[model samples]
Target: MPNATGGQPPITGQVLFYKDPQPLSAENHGGLGVRQIAEPFAFLRAAHAVPVTVTEFGVAAASYPIIFVGDERTPVAVMGVRQGQNLFVDQNGYVFEDYYIPAFVRRYPFVFAADESSDRLLLCVDRAAPMVSNQPDVPFFENGQPSKFTTDAIEFCKEFERQRRATTDFAKIVASMDLFEQKTVTFQPRDPQGREVGPVQKVADYWAISEERLNALPAEKYVELRNNGALGACYAHLVSLLNWSKVVNRAVRTPPPGQAVS
Candidate 1:
């Protein structure tokens, strides 16, 4: 994993599983249905990437039908959305329009997870939040009574605000880029069996891989990569707009390139 600034890389690992005790019995099943889970990953595996899995077994209420949004057998980055309304399975079996996002959901579109018991939704940090604090949760089993959810939510909001204050200007740069004008590309990779897979995403695996490689390069090499599209055009544009002027001027004002002036 690389820090937000694209610094201090850490080993990236696959997500293993995410499970809720709720039985799969819901009428509409929503996005947590087994079909959705198995299908997307079938595509990811075909693309030569590891798919997160739900490997463990647990009791699921027969009355509600087990809804496995994700499991231990395969781990994928997930954005959990809690729907409070019981859209109960319709006679036709599909959930209502309001149930799923009108269109396929793009990942990290929201800032935080929604409250299962409340109407308010949490957008993931990738959304418009100012900042979101990442607080690890204490493990709780099937019967565990958890009191920290509220506290954690508050802390997350606070940290989000703090980080927002720090990076507000940077965000402005992205906004100015007018990415909305561009048509985002997505890929439907195939499995070994040639079955199609994964979610409709912003870009293909090649672009994502290229971005990672570019982030690992030294500054000058990174510039060269950007020109070649090995890195992202947006990142290269940002560098031209900001760092080239501000960072270089700050360095020049201080002293010789390698020396600190007292």
Candidate 2:
């Protein structure tokens, strides 16, 4: 959007899956809005992993392995073993079956970004998103006021921000307890005659919550975790690791765009 001086407005921050996010405003986005698309989640096809909230651990465990990445030990659902591949999502950008969809993916196109000018978070949109259009079925504004769609989106963003903060606190608590361990994920392809052939290929290496260590912690600390509502998430993550084979199977079955399965 053009400013009064005919220059583009400043961008707040760079976020994942958001290429060109602009702060939502009635003045700038009055004519721009979002609409439903045939494949709303097509963007997820290229996302190998995405941030997930701690609260989603139990359900998310059934679909994908939740691992921690980056310095913050941020938990994420590992979608595909290969880079830019989401095995669950087909070429058409849709899930192959009914799976637990992360809230992060559900709230795409609309995200909350901190406005440097104000202490509060500002609602932003990825103007380049496929669902965003010049002629939108759901207008962001109605007569210079936020439409119901936009208001609901705002509420969703607010809740997401709350969950994000809670998830961050959970990570911090776990980190403080020193319950994480470095782990590697790998796969080996088998050949005919039921023989395992080819070199062992590494899928990923990440930080994981150590169940043994968690069990060894002081009783008071464990109680503290339980009280803070982190014990369940920790165990849920541990259990989710078993799904690594599921992700690997999908990866092996569905090779990269130009590659053949070994």
Candidate 3:
């Protein structure tokens, strides 16, 4: 967007995604461990391009159910024994291990916005879409009321870790989920004057992988991509689909705050 002085003014409120580079591990500290995962954004920050949030992280399988509420009201349950010890949830709430929290975030869409005052930003699941019911079928969190999935997720890792102990072959402790087929909407940002810059192409390319690869993705990985505007591809394609030049010209000619044709 342009300023009154006619420059490519600092972009305010532009949403960007920074891909995490490593698996969530004990070394970095909960959530903090994966903060550096999005290295590209680091480069931007060095150049004074601060992101509102470092939106996503990666983790292993068996952690998705703990971070999300399935469309099915009835939760998926698992139990087993280790070192002559019986590990179980006692038919109440599901128990998750900390190692998997980062991965589960990948399955759903999330948003991060800059706080403006400090370097730290806000991170949370997109209220527009949230954890689905984990019963009969998995689906999106219902309208208006975005579930506390992300909020619960933040603390879930700590609790899981506190209760966790060293044990080999945690076969019983590990669990997997079958998420429902779903669709999403993409929104391209406009310049300050509200001129649509079109979809960010690079973002789209990063997400284009085979259905097989997608199917193999754990829920957390899936949620991270989906949550971080997975629609970037479709959104970018819309420029060609809807005539990119025409849209840009229309925005320029509209005589708005950011669109004064030169």
Candidate 4:
């Protein structure tokens, strides 16, 4: 998604899953069309993590560690242990055989952007996406009207925006509770002989909702969390931590450093 902070310069740096995003319009994109994504994760090959919405906690927890990023506490599904690496994606650009795919990834190339003036979201698409083409297998419009494919994309973007709003609210609650703590994950390295060598290595430093602090919350606050459906998401995040090692292990099995996985 475009930066939540309105009126910022076009999102600089890598825009996560999107390559080049532009608002969809009949005037500028009337000749465009999209093809079915045979490899759903092709765009995710370069991403180590993907933004996740609150409603995806359960399924996301099953496949990857769900954690918050930065001071905003943005929820994300961790796909790799290091920056710029995605262990789940194989050389063919497909995610692990049967892993749960986050909606954020599945909705690739199509996203919603807020029109600051109108205070409404407009559906956008990545013009550089491989699926996008003038000779597309599926047309985006027909006779100046949105085609079935475009209609479906619009509906999907709307649903994703609704989930995104709920995610923002959930993040606010987590932040307000003051439950997060900085944590460092470390692992021992192996020599060519595969023997553990040297001191432990730091994998990542990140924030997580402190379980100790959560357990110590006042009864009223705990009850409030339960009533608001955040309790399950919290535990799911905690449980997902176990998958961190799984990601590290996959990284270890990948082709040695400096070699591209894809």
lDDT of 2 at 163: 90
Model 1 over residues 102-129: C-alpha lDDT tens digits?
A: 1112121122333344444332222121
- In terms of lDDT, the best-performing candidate is 2
> TM-score, each model?
0.20, 0.93, 0.18, 0.89
Clashes of each: 37, 0, 29, 0
Candidate 2 per-residue lDDT, tens place, 234-260, comes to 999999999999999887778795676
Write model 3 residue lDDT over 7-83, tens digit each, in one string: 12122453323232121112221222111122211112111111111122111212211111133211111111111
Q: Which candidate's TM-score is highest? A: 2
Error (Å) of candidate 4 at residue 36 is 4.1
Clashes of 1: 37
Deviation in angstroms for 207 in model 3? 16
Selected candidate, larger TM-score, 2 vs 3: 2
Tell me how many residue pairs clash in candidate 3. Answer: 29
Task: Report every candidate's CA lDDT.
Answer: 0.26, 0.85, 0.27, 0.80
Instruction: Give the distance in Å from residue 66's predicted Cα in candidate 1 to where it truly belongs.
Output: 30
Writing each residue's lDDT as its tens digit, candidate 4 over 54-100 gives 88988888888888888788889888877777888876778888788
Question: Over 4 Å off in model 4, which ranges?
Answer: 1-14, 36-40, 191-195, 256-262
As for model 2, its CA RMSD to the true structure in angstroms is: 3.4
